[model samples]
Target: MRADRLVSLVLLLRRHGRMTADRLARELEVSTSTVLRDIEALSTAGVPVYAERGRHGGYALLPGFRTELTGLNHDETLALLSAGPGRGERAFGLGPALASALRKVVDALPDAHLATASDASRRLLVEPETDLLSRWPVTEDVPATTMAEVRSAVLTGRRLRLLYAATGETARWRTVDPVGVVTVRDRAYLLALRSGADRTYRMSRVLAAESLPDPAERPDEVDLDRLWRDRCARFLADGHLTVLVRVDPTRRDDLLNTAVAVRTEQPGPDGWPRLELTYQDAWHAEWALWQLGPHAEALSPPSLRTALHTRATTLANRYG
Candidate 1:
């Protein structure tokens, strides 16, 4: 796994002080190019690692750098292990590997702290995938091979070709310069540039991905979090159909899951909660409200009200 390899790379550097790219590659059993890419990723992630240019020059961690978690006290270890890997690892197809890594870490803990940390980890409970309402967690199924290709492309800074199935569009081929991958709420997205334009593709929507040999054209440094936020803002700002809804407070979460964004939320005059929601279009707005049945009422955009009323009347007359 890349995570394990990265950790091993750091440990190798820390132990050996300095090592050439070829030496590291042989140790890690990966190509020299792959070792170089890993070093770049580590540097970008704020690890105090730097390269030297002379013949004796190689990759090295800054002096006195330590990647030790053994210093963690019992409580700290418990908290770390208790939280576990969760769905994020599964989303990235690293569940088993992460679980193994955690076990290794626990095993490496001091003998005095080991038993206590293990027992404590078992005692603490993380939230279940299903909630009290029996709503199952959203699990996007991105093929393992597809995810691997995309991940490799991002890690290696290579260009990518994707067979993407975009929302409301037919599946098509696209070429992009991959920047990074981000997982939010169990959904993975590939953040990349398509012809110098920002493009984000949901990992599940990528039917297939090919890592091209050509290097990706991208800035040396990236602010992935900021870029993701900016893209999200632009997406939410475009062609959204605003909806004002009065809904049963208990069903608010259900309503939220279906909407694009929640603009404003307050108590309604009728003793219910009022929410200003946005959807992709009028149809989406109407459908989301309808799903809640009488628990939700659309209060604006005459057209949506009429559409719902017409549907209700049609159903009512047929059932009557």
Candidate 2:
């Protein structure tokens, strides 16, 4: 733990150029005395760190000094480089920080693996800017001042006063306890509680927000992953169609990935997998099955099979 702290301390100085002992302590979540001891440890371990004394002075790394940290294996190097194109940066308000961090990740790789990794990463696209049928990602205008308040309230366990619009409702001011922020498919949601009931508000829907001075009346800890999953299940259950089908095993992953909700799956006697799924509508079920080509077959709720048949007939006639 101390070794990690020492390394982190060095990196902090490296990234920021210099930091005062108190600032380092706050960042590292340690005592100022502990920070001083870590600096001594780093210096003793042959790191080129030094302190300057003055009202405007702090600790800094020597010129051109850097800790050697090229430990990524070939696959790991490529994996690290496989990042999406700045959608997260826009959603989380990270802006240019993601770009800067990615640059550092690539530059930190060993010399021999660097070229190979960079070359391989180029051939892979996480989310390309455009394709033949490109839908440009629209940037949502989540006001910086409002987001700042929401983030602070969530992080500090404080309540927030929000001028929010619920589906078709007018924007109204109400105090709510902050839970956490969730980003799904580039859209941000603020998960919080109002009147002790869980509520989810889209960031785009929040007209304005302010951090309340009072501490939020909520649990000390929340299982956000579990909570999000439960919410998603409940959401899909509302006005969503359920379809049972049989899919080839090889295409199982593709089906699961593309489906709105994979309710259940089981091995079938015919060597395929039986899948129960939920989708927004009959049209959605039709489109998803179409993507799987002949690998998937709709088995129930005859309307879905009808939709597929109609689509296939349309395609056949078009080609005819």
Judged by TM-score, which candidate is best?
1
Evaluated at residue 297, the lDDT of candidate 1 is 94
Model 2 CA lDDT for position 306: 89
Q: What is the TM-score of each candidate against the true structure?
A: 0.73, 0.58
Model 2 / residue 171 / CA error / Å: 3.3
**Can you give the lDDT of residue 157 in candidate 1?**
91
- Per-residue C-alpha lDDT of model 2 across residues 265-320, encoded as one tens digit per residue: 88999999899998888888888899998999999889989889998999999999
The runs of at least 3 residues in candidate 2 whose Cα sits more than 4 Å from the true structure, single-residue gaps closed, are 1-86, 100-124, 130-145, 247-259, 266-273, 281-297, 302-320
Q: Candidate 1: what lDDT? A: 0.88
- Give model 2 RMSD, 1 decimal: 9.9
Cα error of candidate 2 at position 215, Å: 1.9
Clashing pairs in 1: none
Residue 37, candidate 1: Cα error in Å is 38
Error (Å) of candidate 2 at residue 266 is 4.8
